[model samples]
Target chain A: MPLRHLAPMLAALLALAVQAAPGNGDSGTQPEDRSHLPQLGDPYLPPAARKPAQRPPLAGAALQAQARAKLQQRFAAADTLKTGSISLAQAKAAGLGYVVQHFAEIDRQGSGRVSFEQVVSHQQGAR
Target chain B: MPVSLKRTHSYLLAITLALAACGGGGGGGSTPTQPTQPGNPADRGFSDPLAYSSSGNASLSVANEGAALTHHSLNLGGRVIDYTATAGHLIASHPQTSQPKAAFFYVAYTAKNQDVRTRPVTFFYNGGPGSASVWLHLGSYGPKRLQVGYPATSQPQPFPLVDNQESLLDTSDLVFVDAIGAGLSQAIAPHTNQTFWGVDADAEAFRDFVTRYLAVNQRTASPKFILGESYGGVRSSVLADLLEAAGTRMNGVILLSPILNYYSNCAVYSPGEANCTGFLPTYANTGAHFRLTNPAQTDYAAYAQQMRSYAASTYGPAVASWLGSRLPPSNSLVDQLVGLTGARANLWQANLSLHPNTYQFQLITGTVLGRYDARVTAPQGSALASEGDPSSTFITSSFASTIRSYLTSQLKYTAQTSYAISSNAIQSWNWQHDGQDLPDTLPDLAAALQQNPNLKIMVLHGYNDLATPFHQTELDLARLGNVPGLRIHNYEGGHMMYLDDASRVRTKADLVTFYASALN
Candidate 1:
């Protein structure tokens, strides 16, 4: 199943586990006892609440390629203050600090800039 | 990890050697020799001894409370060193067997020139697994206060200190603790930064501190109290539970602009059934205070009576309806309430929920120059969505100015570097705990009252504090029911209700009475 569909089922399962556990007042330490407290009244409502009129899932590879393109665009903007190579400070100033930090960890090649193939390589390595 | 530990030790050694060399006579005249025996292990007080000495000119004489305070650093189980310091003031003399703990504290008593009184000591702290007790130490109730209204760059450069006639020392002794890493406090061995940097870990550390304090101070008979602000309120609950388990008790617990329920308060800012229900009443009350609403009432009690009716009847339904359908008519009372909150009608018209940022900008821009001081309104400007809190700017500025001057000039504790007032270390704190998932402190509060029967709890809140809305607090207490001796008071101010003149005076009076009763 797609990750999007899997997310809710996982959330529901977690909630169920919490409900099954005993009450200890300390929510972080104990599994939540959902039985005695209060029930959601409707369990099916969540998925229905989130569903739009109509939507289609993008292929996983296509989604990855799209994400790579967006990241490259951001890197280009962040390289504005580059002195031959972009720096973290410049990336921070350009509002791409979060992305720059992530890319830095993934770049691995020691190159100043990242290429599409490098992006694909990093994506594969992550899995 | 071990390499980093070695590097840190080497750095400390180098700094110690540098200080020693500088003391051997450098640029200045004859060097003052380091005390060979370390100046009475009990008197190695205050992390920054120089800040207290050179800044204030008052003569130091031990008051009736007794011996001078002793300061020491404790390893709170982390690479980050925590200071476990206290002042030893004699409350009463007793036999060796009757002596409680040998306690020490850091205190900013009345300026040496002022008349001394047997003031009630109000113990205060902030919450954050990583937060120090600086918020109460400098911003709200300390003898040395921060000055408000000044640009960040336009300092004299360091502001002059003033005598805080407002200091609670006249009514109570104050003790501020730096939890784990945020302040001068450090963690003990075996417990790393991660160990002391979470919910349970922080509570256990405070529990240890309290246990140690009671054992050291002999204050077992003294009326004990706690004052926690923001997340500290949540922390106070956990501390209460731990203390109860240890058989210790408190006279009262005061929560200042507390964040008790993270899901209800912090996660949601806009007006929605899920997020905004708890906070709307406070927003309405603040609007009523600023004369933004149609009701031009100054008395909050009368206004609250009127608001409760509206909240249960009209306002509640209108919100439910608006959430379900297209934008309701502009003339609706809900719209008026939203408008009075200083939020743009269009935004409410668009999103139905008004985030804290919107309400803050909408309400104060015309009268105050900054977003923090809702009391002061600035000139109107083009309405734009704010990225973060405008009030934080004011809170940070006011605290920075007040604590710096108060610590150095009044109490006479000097340090090499400025005190760390607040940090982002606790911004993303999680409160969900395992096991009995208690409200953290309520059970302890119940136990304290059950144990003493005379213990009273005074819960005060500013009507305008959207940070911790009054209604949610009311609901939280409702779940706990009446504790027989507890009294709840609602003030006519925001998160820092004591900043308001009337509320501050009233709070002081109430505290004095409460302390007298607790002791008697």
Candidate 2:
């Protein structure tokens, strides 16, 4: 079978192994028996009653890449001189707020302009 | 491997020298320091939707593998403690279907040759709501600590790691577990990390993680404890209750610089409408620290106590005037506020409430006090500056770099994917809990107390912590009705109290007493 078709099968096998594994370890090590203790109800609100999750659709590198792409596009647009770099004034005009904020750090050589690579590397180091 | 080597060059050199002294048996297991990327989706056991490439190329996924165990000994002052470090991932699955949902990355340090039944095990996590457990692992009670001085930004070069004389390893085994989407933890296929980002769901995931950890390590009979810092406090409150339901009874629950209730956190309220009663004492303490108070109080604790009494007696009742009737604070109250908080009389008159930001910015000329730590200040930066907290900026790089070095070079657990020190999922966190839009976990804690009266609770605070004011935690825990099992201690440091050398020693001593009491 193709690998895509095998993904769910492997997941199922892993899930079965997970289910078969002992949970609470009532043996091996002497475990506490809390049968006499009062039992508590469900710890969470019912799914219908609970508030919906509010997480952003994209996450991890995918989200970061989207953001990075936007910045690069902005930089490209700002580099109207086609000198392969953007000056602080051009950055300011394009509303590249982050570039304007860290202009000195990005323009490390003090050339008053920064390449797209410099911006990318700076962001990676910051992360 | 070269990338890993480059990042850990300094630490690798140190480890090489140290191994030479130890006669070379202390190296971590044969697990590769850099894990090979999974070739296919099935190799990782599931398809990771998060495994995407911006370039539309083949994406990489973290391999599903067993832990890498390393053995080492630390000479903590004089007494040496030999410990085994287990660094890896444990799968947390769906409750009903038992399908793997998320992988929780954890680093566990257990004293070698200790009896599994008797040795205590404590789980530690820092709270960003989306933060990794790196802070508690490197900055606080772990066997090795990242050294960065307070009140000034840490220099990037020469980030050092030292044996933590105050490591809790002597008292109990420590396990630092990162939440899903943070550190090396990741969500499996069909369930995104967002599935566990809410208040209740987050607690459930942790409850599963803890139970799984116990079963796998055969630590079920050990005296159990959970320590949560900052937003981890919220997770702990709910987790404590959920763990009880799962039949894992903890001996103690520790809250460090916790925000137990968000309704009164001042972040939820508009400026001038926030409750100033809880914040007054913290402001007074900060003022005294800067010698900004009128009396030039040298004794910060005593001044804070005086302010606390005044707030409870006079300011607490008078707060209703502004919060309810839009009435101005009494002139006497205004005078007292100005004298204690170092704010101008006009500012206090115009607004009875003093927001932390206003105090942080206006407390001193040309300097901004840290929100996490009022004692640390920096020359104000541009409005669009990436980092706003002086406390965070100065010390963050040191901690960040040190963790990566320590993990790969020392602990020997490495990953292909970048370890996220913090995730951005908090931007869309579901705040609703127990029907309140703003979470108040005190009820969950109270329920845990009711269910397990034997559960010992200790709430710690730093007097200089502006993020979670000490007084608010005091007021929140007061509703538990004077339970003797509960102990609250405040130190003179910031939110991460262990960052201060003096506070770390004091806090460790306090924890030593707490662990003994709980175990007994």
Candidate 3:
């Protein structure tokens, strides 16, 4: 996200925090309250509450599995030609947004192309 | 709440659109083979939703979504005013194609025994490219208001639903319009809610709706006005021009705490020049209100005005000079800034800009100021992040519940579909307008003014609004050159100035005068 948009996004998230609060008992259940719109039917409700931030991080095999799977998915999407690797330009063109930000770090060998394993190693090393 | 939150959604949408586009291939000139389907069945070939096909059935028409009309009387200071409230949807078709698009919802209160041609009608909408019109409908000028005490969280419901003595009904007829996907509004099948989620497309949708409204109600000749708050200001600007170009002349346009140019905003995501010049006055205004800064400056409004002058003459030039040179600004400049904004001298010394978040956080120790209304504050539980604006959180549920109750018992309009206070369509809003990367609707507003020489414009802003600072609006309007018919009003409230009792009454009074003058 652009720095200009960060404040507004934080503001929005904060507003969402309020909207997600439990209702004030009136879920429009009254027989005469036929005009009330139900909260359950609201399409804009947040998909799900975020996982607790303090939860223990995945480690060992579980971490590796998750990291490998994520890298594979991203690499496959970016490497549209099925070349098993992608150039920085390819990654950018593919809209690998945040990944593109770390393209140089991932392609540490400076060969101009990064493999899925390279990305996974980069993630694991960073972690 | 709606405006701020939905903006984040629209930014996400912009990225989504970019990613979606990246997956698509470039041009294909050759047409070698025909598809299985010869043509699109859903294509109406530029026909209005209300227009019948050769084999016509009224029941199947998209525009056949009927209205629920309820008669009501509101006593404003012992003067009983009888009115008819019509709640329903108007199908807004594509401007060029005329294909049925979205069914835009609206609730209009027309005073009894008024001449359709002479009586002024104002269309009101709240900002939140994603928000419903309920804020203005129930929380502001609708005959019924959700009672909220200034600077205090509304008590648990049943929240008081009282007659708004400050309602403009006595002066002009009111029509509250919900943007597509908000409230009961939704896109007709074949077209999704995102169809009308961009700057131009959204304005076009509202233009179509307003025109259709006039035609349907046989009030095309009536004196018309538009009142849009927050992002609605951008809509009103574009919509005004669109309506005028289509020959629907508007008598007036009212913008409340509007952000006219996105590129000049202080919170732009892109790295650029730190342009906090416009926000200085608001920061000072808020600080003064809270008695954190300029405590000796008893008159907050006058102090804010003085700060505007200081910003123009001293602070703005000093920042420009600092940006031009590597040398830090003079100590005197830093002291003046620190004194006015109550921000740390180090913050001003580091960068001549004070972001609203930083100011909101630092204005009062252990108390985070509300972004919408600085007067409202909450305990700073964590230094890392804000829970939400106390102003927004306090009244949202109260207003939402009250509107739903009013709709059900008073307006007699009900539906199985929830009246979405806001939509997620902002998650995919197309921000491109006039072939530009970002929208700047001042040109559109100026064009409208040029087109209709008699068109009157009123801008209302609050002193403590951090989202769209009142000074920013002043700067934007100054760029419009000399506009004789344009009027600006500032009050002691925030973005929704009507949330404050005194500001609400003052705003209504000003609006009443505006309507009378515009009609004349």
Candidate 4:
């Protein structure tokens, strides 16, 4: 068992915690049904009714704005030295759980870090 | 499945061979030991005694002296008659001495009707207690063969045929045998069906087949070889031991994507874990292939070195902890250790455990590149949730069509029924509860190599195969303790190394050189 292999299962565990959050109800359950859902198998999930997430639906512009704001917030929180650009260690500190959880989804290079361009692309994709 | 004429003839041949081998009592062991002579008191000629009344669209041509086909029937304990197909030019006289209750085999020699003294004999069989020797016969080695696409595909029709340019018959004489119930081989009378079904029984039967073939052919002096695939790898290992016990030694043993260990390789109980371990190297390799990890790091040797270090130290602990609880501050030390292995960001984000499926899906989705190799992606699913394997899609599809076509069109052998090209025959296989129990054939193989120093073993693996990871094979071979002059090679392919163009060429070359070396 290598660290590279543990990454996904760890992400899944973190994703499980996010699912347990009350307002994020459908975020966890709905994605499970999505074709892009993780394939760890059905045994991990209990056979109970799943409540959906309760996030507000934002339109194209609003979504883009929200994504940018979130990205900025993450960068600021991760940049302990107050440096404009967030370093790899800075990103890990901001939200190691969140970053590791969504790294593959965001880091298109699969290098496991968010570059400025990658962050911008992610924000645009959300729109 | 309609009974095809060709299949019916092949079945007849199998039944005849089975009956001839298992028929007689104590005295039948006295059959002469000559290379070309027929030893069975009942072996009349090249044609089947149980003739078919119907005529076919294709005509059967009897080639003159050097090219005619010889036929025989062997009884393997079952009353059912089994037949065998052999080239006439290959048969030689039987030896003077014979063992009692030995299994009979048909030998097909190459070298243009040359004496058995001149050419080496290679014994070949496919795995499947129920499978016939068709794949090796038509796909790779047998002289006359059926061709399919280079990578192989299911038959377009029920039957498709092609000419095989890679056949090994040009190099060594081949003897294609059907297990007791497969092909044209069968059991005769008195001996129960149970005699040739189980593990030990099967080994005994094959041992008998080789000894009988050697005695009848009178070529005990020539180099002998055994080539098997999949489960046949297990069979060959056991047979290597059995052959030694029966006083015959093998010069070389060739295993094509062999399954030598079941515990580490085939036990799919822990899907996520099993696949993760198996596919890790493949991912590193794939990443290296696409320059995803680092373009400068091209070869797998360097990749494997990094991965091995990660797996043994930080990677192992990170996965263990993640599966249970958060690691202490020292655990972060493990993460830092992982960072040193390259791909620091990736290792940290994975929190250290990368499931096989996640790696597979991530590689494709993140990189926009698909990994056709299963060995790299096979173990990515949840251990308890996913069905068998995602990789089986390509493997089964590719082998099915080509096998169907080759059997029907080229060999002109058909069955009134459908043959199982591959199956879960070992689904019920249980590991020995005792720690000392042997889970695979490595023990027998090691013993054989130890007893006969001249015996050589060659293992070929597809780097992309997750089914039986090349690493697991490497690990097991190392554990065998007896470090003979063994050669192991990796092809950039899957479990079936021959499916890849590059692998097939390298494999053929390696095998030819191996055989040549063994004989000298």
Candidate 5:
């Protein structure tokens, strides 16, 4: 369960930066994802099918620990700017702002930084 | 719990949020967990197996009428789900002559596991009034997807596609549909697309396609679901009503980043108009994403929740009073609008209220935030923000070419007609249907819900999408006032939320849960 929670988040923050695809827009709300796609044509030869992209083969159970380790690395990297805590500017620039923003949301005591344990505790309560 | 705060915990908390979304448990409820599927390279097809000429874009006239089927398997939910991929045509013929004229195209994936009769079937499509199904197909739900580009990153050419781990094949069979004049589907000799391009007519055509598909596939007894994104979301609502009336009752309807109300989503509404207020929370969310908001605004979710409440209860009403000077405008109101929108109070006063378009460019002084995903910005794009969606451009660049590779190479569904992902059909579309309900689909949704109390609807939105902001959906749903079977879930991404790896996982789980809850 913990693994389930960590995988997508760690992946999403990185993935939102990646965009590829064709013809996905809608009128009014259409993504305009379709606007720039190159048109298709070639009468004789069949277009070679593309391979499907994939996440690493790690199971959900491994994702929790994997995610935690990756996060510590991220924090360590950001710590170069400021030890123990990443500044708001650092967080935004690193594209880790969503994490900081959410922590602040549940950081009820008005404390600048929210601890992992507090988040766990609060989440348990919220659930 | 330790009260000590650390910035690192923000990352941990994100995991929790993602987990909350994933924890809905998308596993097939009744189908016992089969042994974990072993990894098979061939099952997923060759890596970068698709290749196409780069001299120019592919032609749009080559289409084959043949129904192409390919067998495949993917490792999903820890199980190897074997399935059939069919790229087929649903021909629309003259009712009197019974002669085929035009053809509607679809790509379907039916899992080899479980009884075909009882397993759920979900039809997926994108909205363009004239768009193909490739967006939702490869972008979100299908097993294959073109490489997605990151913000500001140019996609590597010879666009590569990859196996989609987040494919919804875990709980339901998928059929991605393309409308007439899009993809391989087009108008026929006996029948012209002129009749099929309107709102009502389009709905009827889709209805008949589903009916014919079910009859041909012999899946009339399966649990049915309709999923449409963007304009497709609007279409999904109308399609729901049409399908039910056609005696094809669906168990559920799923709308992704849906725009249920056109007026509320767009237009120059008077200051404090409902539509203007709807953009408030989205504006804040985008601000937080880009760190444009006050640094003191730490908690993004809490901020958005508070904003939603204000928008629905207080701010929305306060803004509406500006119409005709019915209620004298107050400084406090302007200050509140400024506070909520993060733009200058003077700007708010000048405009009477902050519109999404005005704020789109204003939030960040130089670049424009994408309409599909407000968090992403492009300095060179049109400031109007209406020229096209920047975020979507990044996606289509990859998908447009990749699908051709998929259809021709993978599915072997060759056609003499060229594939049109985004079609010109929208240009000729007839919008004059029923004035009683302008362009909004909320009325259709309400009636559909009433007609079938058993029907379930799940409206989803991307947190970053300004085009169909999550908060606007909240406002619309609130107006609907808690119908029994309708639920709303917002993922942490833009219009095509699934493009974001995290949102894709979260959405797959959400869709799976919706299917299970509604169908089971």
Candidate 6:
């Protein structure tokens, strides 16, 4: 980032020291009442919440493992994998974006639902 | 401030330079075979996820992939300053479901080493709800602009991007945003275009983007302003009020050739029709500029001013009375209209109520004046109503092509998606908002200004522009009951008047003065 953009980040960090109090309900809370947020269903919503200070996505092996765990927790743990696939709602609740992310890789047959083995393989191949 | 921060800045600059050098093989593009760098920022490289500070909201994840950042130095207003230009995407998700929505493309410029609270950052938008920010980005005062000489000024071609000393960067940072369908911005997955294809939806999206940008950038405490052109001028009024209501306060707004009310500019007069004589003065000014007016006067400003006064006093009333079947044939009024607009005296006398389009065509019969700036004219090329705009003929590809080249060759923002300077979003755009006031943004503007009396507004217009005539805006503002800091300035050129050297210089002076006034 350039210094011109840096000043604000620095200022926010300083402000965050005071403003991020529990009472302020600062944006750190995951999945808050976003219904109240402007431009509902806005395709660009992710960036809307991306303040200067954010925790970037998990990358590499960590990301792969997390994806697998999230899938397993949302699918296999719920026995949805017994049907050899999971629904779109299952994928979303797991914090996985279907069309935009690697959901297609796991859904090997081009079907919306992915087989349990395919999900495992997809995570394994994510290096 | 911190030594570590300084070191990181140097490191980032070094990496940015190296990346730029790696793509230096981009030749002066002539043929497709030697294809120079493309303008898609996505082709640059997938970037590290933008991580918020670990201390606050560390869980927020933003994958603005392919975002490119680079630094450039320019001597603006007699001072050499290094500034950074960034090309990136802003992602959107469903507010309730947190389902990923789409990516909004944008480019931003900021002067290095400055306190932002008092000084401000301006987000710029070009008119067509579907228009890209490229025009103002490379055309006006956005750090770097094109040298494609506009008509009535210089010869065309040799569109090179150079450091614009007139850029507002010396005063404030700038971020040019592409409305959803324009430029590289788009709707993702199941979200579809309809999700953001309307007025309320568009305003909310833009408002969210501004809020998110400020929050993410940690500029929540900084002063913010919006600069919108054309339809974006109307957008600025709604944005000013919406953003402020959404917890983001604006210090000022700059409207360029703003169309405050649609009925005023392009209204069709009929039974119960409001006499929109706003285009009269502009028709006369356009006539004056082209030396088409009969019994023409050499003094342009004086003649325009006189016509403006007559538009409301005599011309407007005459048309309104004619609509009521109460108007009488007035010979001197016809002569004045003929002298001011260069139209045949009989056209004015025979038909007291002149339509905006016919009035435009009659000014230089058979040749239509450009809808953007009447000062321009071309061979009446087509009979198609769709292709009627004459001034738009040059600016369309001129702005898009130059911006693409500048971004690719100069900033190294490359992607597979071709840059679109403008799109047909206007055709599909849902113009309906909460307020059914199509022709007047004054209520919303007044609402905002009333809430923040300290907020200043600078309305700039090119006198020769017939599209969003300056006189119409003058009449519109006149009815808005005592706005404290609203000042309108008229210039010699047409819409996008900054294309002229003199206009650009004068416009910048006014801007510098405005920004300075706000700072104090």
**TM-score against native, each model:** 0.58, 0.71, 0.70, 0.56, 0.68, 0.68
* Ten-residue region with minimum lDDT total, candidate 4 chain B: B51-60
* Second chain TM-score for model 1: 0.69
iRMSD, all candidates: 25.5, 30.2, 21.5, 26.4, 24.2, 26.9
Q: Per candidate, chain B TM-score? A: 0.69, 0.87, 0.85, 0.65, 0.82, 0.83
- lDDT score, candidate 2, position B346: 54
Cα lDDT of model 5 by residue, B357-430, tens digit: 55655555555666677766655434323344456555554677778777777766666544667655544555
Tens digits of per-residue lDDT for model 2, B1-520: 2322332443343233222222212232222222212221111111122232111112123324245556677788888787667676676755545666666778888776566677889999887677778888988999988776675563554357888899999999899998776777766555667777788888888887887777656677889999999888899988887675355768999999887877656633434545767888888888888877888887767887898798888887786566565555578878888888787665555555666655655667556676677787766553211244566555666677777777776666666655667765465567787656656777677656644668999988888877788887887777555677999998887888888888899999999999999998
lDDT of 3 at B7: 31
What is the per-residue lDDT of model 4 for residues B1-520, given as tens digits with 9 covering 90 to 100?
1212223554444434323322222122232322332343333334333211111111112111111233332222342222223421111111222212212223353333334454677888776444555566655655433333323333343333333344455556677765544443433223323335445666667776676566644557667888886667777887886575344767888876666755444223322232234445655665555455643456666666676666566455555665454332255554453333223344334334443333334443322111234432232233211233333332333345665553443233343333344222232222231122323566567656643567888888776654455665776676654455588877776655664555666777888888777876
Worst 10 residues of 1 chain B by lDDT: B51-60
Q: In Å, what is the interface RMSD of model 2?
A: 30.2
Candidate 2 per-residue C-alpha lDDT over A83-108 given as tens digits, one digit per residue, 9 for 90 to 100: 99988888767645446767799788
Pairing residues by index, what is the TM-score of model 2? Answer: 0.71
The per-residue C-alpha lDDT of model 1 at residue B453 equals: 51
Ranking by lDDT: 2, 3, 6, 5, 4, 1
Per-residue accuracy of model 3 over B1-520 as CA lDDT, tens digit each: 2222323443343223222211111111121221212132211111112322111111212433345555567789999876667676566766445666666778888776666678888999876667788888887888888777766653555468888899888987899998876787776646566767788888988988887677666677789999998778889988887786565879999998887766555643211234678889888877677666844566867888799899989988876665555245578888888788777675565556556655665556566666678888766553212333556656667777777667766666666555677765544557676545556666677666654668899999998887778888888777666788899999998877898998999998898888888987
> CAPRI band of model 1?
incorrect
Q: Scoring each candidate complex against the real one, what DockQ results?
A: 0.01, 0.01, 0.01, 0.01, 0.01, 0.01
What candidate 3 gets wrong by more than 4 Å, as runs, is A1-127, B1-63, B95-97, B268-273, B323-327, B382-386
Best by the lDDT measure: 2
